[model samples]
Target: MKNLKVNPSNSLKTSRLVIRIFASLITLFYLIAFVPKLIQMLLGDAPERPPGADWEGSMVTVSFLIFILGYIVTWWRGLVGGIIIAIGSILMFLTHMMSASGEFEFLPFFVFSGPMLLCGILYLVFWWKKP
Candidate 1:
């Protein structure tokens, strides 16, 4: 295979563009998933508490904010934000499991953590490839 390039500068710019695209996608996904929850919290219309202060939801909120900050920093920090997002995802998964076993089927784990986990995995993969 030919390692063809219009020029080294073009190749570098292309690489940066790819990274930025991935970062933006991650940011957009998080924003779409989290903004509604934050609005609900602000409007004092947050969902019903899940037995114990809704720690899972709280983590999701905090991790989303951290991810936003990470986007402002560097992609590496953004990767850290992805890790926080993954933590939130894990908490959400646990909450769902607990809620299921507690004789009730309730929780918004799918909406709350699904994107977090997916974006975390996607960005983590990108971060690993980044030099």
Candidate 2:
């Protein structure tokens, strides 16, 4: 083939960097939030609560897919995925709160919800700020 190369400009490079570093980190965090449950499930244990297990798994998987799609598309959807994660976290918290004998603990909430909120903020600050 003849000499032909498609080179992305400087801005494209910078955007890619943001998506890979910021978006991907957030996505990974959200994914990690599910690992304890996922590990339990893999070991034949059910979640203490089950409303969002499947949804959370799907969201984590989709967030990873969005990172993969970054080569072709913007990683903006990771922000949306992060929002979904946060909502799921809230719903789970509410369900637990409404339970007759549930206790409120901060670690679970922080691990799941905090990363998601941060993900949204990072996306807004890094990506949405300009576009």
Candidate 3:
């Protein structure tokens, strides 16, 4: 009989690569969208809003920052970073949902949180399967 065996470490490496690429792509997309606003704010050229400004936008930004932090950390530690990414994605979704008059919207989630949440889940799954 022919013998065949699967090496778990190779699968783990492949999964890790996939998770890293997915997270990197997401981080790149986010940075492309966010860096301009960040630069504008840093340059003190952001448009001034009226008093009692939009707290929702600020909250979204905070959540987005947390997501970015998870992306950075994922390179170092997949398990903890995945947890952070999940939390960030949940916060991002809820914040945007609140800003949309407390209505659940699929479009916003697809655009912002869905891919990130998927990536985070993938990370955790692969981590758990690691040999």
Candidate 4:
């Protein structure tokens, strides 16, 4: 009889750790970003929205939900979480692109979406190589 031992590679371990940490941070960042608005709403001082801003606001809300879900799932399944985050990031990027008036408008989209895409890719890489 032969016995075999399976162990996770260091890269896999490191990647998993990184994914967990990054996912947590990403979730926290999104939640923190909403704190002001939440506070205002709770205090009955929510600012009035400009005309024709509802669609953009709704899109942002949906994307935020997707990111939250993706981060939550990352704790269990890295691949699924990565895909979800990637999808959310892509949707957000497209939304911003569609509404952009010029090159300057893409700055904010890139700033936010770039890290998200990177994190998503990192998670996928780790998931693919998981032992």
Q: Of models 1 and 3, which has the larger lDDT?
A: 3
TM-score to native of every candidate shown:
0.50, 0.43, 0.85, 0.80
lDDT of each: 0.60, 0.51, 0.82, 0.75
For model 2, the local distance difference test gives 0.51
Model 2, range 1-131, lDDT digits (tens) per residue? 79976554666557647646764565566457556766776776764753245554454445434433432233446446445544544554554455444677676556544554454455434444453
> What local lDDT does model 1 show for residue 93?
61
Tens digits of per-residue lDDT, candidate 4, 13-90, equal 876887788767877887887667767767878776532357766777777788778778878888998899899888
Say which candidate scores most in TM-score.
Answer: 3
What is the overall TM-score of model 1 with all chains considered together?
Answer: 0.50
- Return the TM-score for candidate 4, rounded to 2 decimals: 0.80
**Model 3 stretches with alpha carbons more than 4 Å out:** 1-4, 44-53
> For model 3, where is the 10-residue window of minimal lDDT?
48-57
Best-to-worst ranking by lDDT:
3, 4, 1, 2
lDDT of 4 at 131: 68
lDDT for model 3, please.
0.82
Extract clashing residue pairs from model 4. Answer: none
Count clashing residue pairs per candidate.
0, 0, 0, 0
TM-score (C-alpha) between model 3 and the true structure? 0.85
Model 2: ten consecutive residues of lowest lDDT:
65-74
lDDT per residue as tens, model 3, 1-131? 97888888987898789778878888899889777777777787878642124787777787788899988888888898999999999888887787747778888899889988998898889878877
RMSD, every candidate, angstroms? 5.3, 9.2, 2.9, 5.0
